[model samples]
Target: MKIFMKILGIAILIAIGVGFYFRLNDDVLTGDRIIGIAVLTSAFILMPVFLYVRWKGKRLKDYTLSEENLKKMRDKGID
Candidate 1:
């Protein structure tokens, strides 16, 4: 599942790059292209990466402040 997501994310990113290339090269800009880019970026790129990492047992709290983290920070003079 994780491998599949990684592949999907890469594919989406490539599609976005291609979309931008064509849109920028053209003389006329359309609302559809803008909307398509926005939706693809969020749904395909961001969502897949988020889900893949979460599925790997990573938690948001692990990176945020907690008693153990605070204590470590203080000891390291970073607090």
Candidate 2:
């Protein structure tokens, strides 16, 4: 999964770079379409997979602020 994410991220970045190259040379419309598609793919597909992989096996309560967490923080001189 980690390898897959890395490959996907690199591919998307390469696509964006190619899009910019095209835009600078001649095909503005095609470049724009490629850039748009790459951005959308990163946002919708790559982001979710990355987030899921990173967040897997983690406790949500540890990150969220609640009354108990606030008390603990105050006890530890953080608040």
Give the per-residue Cα lDDT of candidate 1 at 55: 60
Q: Which lDDT tens digits does candidate 2 get at residues 1-79? A: 9998899899999999999999999999999999999999999999999999999999999999999999999999996
Q: What is the lDDT of residue 23 in candidate 1?
A: 69
TM-score of 1: 0.45
Prediction-by-prediction clash tally: 0, 0
- Can you write out model 1's per-residue Cα lDDT over 6-76, one digit (the tens) per residue? 77667666766666776677722653475487567778677967766776877777799999999999999
What is the C-alpha local distance difference test score of each model? 0.71, 0.94
Can you tell me which runs of candidate 2 are displaced by over 4 Å?
Answer: none
Report the number of the highest-TM-score candidate: 2
Q: What's the CA error at residue 75 for candidate 1, in Å?
A: 17
Local error of candidate 1 at 58, Å? 8.8
RMSD of each: 4.3, 1.3
Q: What is the lDDT of residue 5 in candidate 1?
A: 67
